[model samples]
Target: MLEHLGEKLILHVTLGNFSFSFDILTVIMSWVVIAVLVVVALILRRGLGQDIEEKPSRTQAILESLIDLLKGQLMSSFSSDKLARELFPFVSTVFMFVLVSNWLSVIPYCESPTKDLNVTLSLALLVFVMSQLLAVRMRGGIRYLKGFLEPYPFMLPLNIVSEIAKPISHSFRLFGNTFGGAILVTVVSAKFAPVLVPAALNAFYGLFVGAIQAFVFAILTVAYINVAVES
Candidate 1:
């Protein structure tokens, strides 16, 4: 069944040592998610009212509610209102992007960007850099390095290893989950060749896997930021 899928619906793009092969439908589906996000951002920025007198539309109200929910989560983690305010945009953007990407995979023939190792790695690296920068900014240069020594001198090496492992784990967790889902769906569709079966699988993908991945991504971001700020 898997072998048959390789011949039927596989999408391939190659450059030098790097090559990507997946279902073309999945690739296009992923991009549609990206496109939708871009459009939503633009629309919200333009349509949101500048003052209380100009009431926001229903769409704007819904967007604001989502942002407020994220804000509340960040606030609970940060403890400092000022810090939460400052960090809100970055955290919010990451949550929305990951949430959308995960949910997009449920669309028939669509592949999630998070399913690609390269894309997930890039996002993890960005978060790693941002976390380090936040740590340095909060504790200063030398203090940031000294942070590893906290609670005991003997634990420094272990702490260092854990820090390095963070990005690797973060990237692979997301990549593996989404990629595995995509592969499972592909194999199932090929084997069953039944319309309703794929739909049921997609419902599970959208309702369960998508929501869990989104929550995990957001919570992890908050946890990492809390570590950086509190260290």
Candidate 2:
């Protein structure tokens, strides 16, 4: 059944007790996504002028608008403007990276990295680590750890379990939706000779469903950060 998955997918590596594996396609495709974003950023940067009153180029305006949107979203989460600004780079980067990764499936020779369990889990784990660090930094270490016992000391274990589950749940939600979409499209395309059907399916899956998952993942990261930093 896995034979239908196009190209060389997984590669395993081992070194003593440290065993590791990754999707070969995901790694290659993610670089392309990053390069494209970097190029767009450079082009947008070129359009900006030092003079405030000068009219901005379309690319500059669009980039500025996106930044504004991200800023507003982050601002809504944090009480401190400085903290919000500090977190904007992380939130915005995740949003753009995931968005690009998802949309790339529409192009030939590219697949959404988010479809890979490893990729989604790694992304989710990043949020988990950052949120925990933010909590420790904002609230003192002892206070942050002690907060798990809130409302009752007996809840500590349950709270810790729930905290651990956040990343697992976050990762699987994206991986399942994206992986399932890819599998369904593949199976249907292989069985049907029609070109239009597969094209439409790809379009809907790549654009609508993929984009929604990316947006949710990015926004949820910010939401988790908010919960972490909240007093």
Candidate 1 per-residue C-alpha lDDT over 62-113 given as tens digits, one digit per residue, 9 for 90 to 100:
7788788887765568867787888788877777778888877666545576
Off by over 4 Å in 2: 6-8, 12-21, 73-75
Name the TM-score of candidate 2: 0.90
Q: Write the per-residue lDDT of candidate 2 for residues 100-124, one digit (tens) a residue.
A: 8888888876789887888889989
Best by TM-score: 2
Local error of candidate 1 at 210, Å?
Answer: 1.2
Q: What local lDDT does model 2 show for residue 66?
A: 83
Q: Return the top candidate by lDDT.
A: 2
Q: Worst 10-residue stretch by lDDT in candidate 1?
A: 1-10
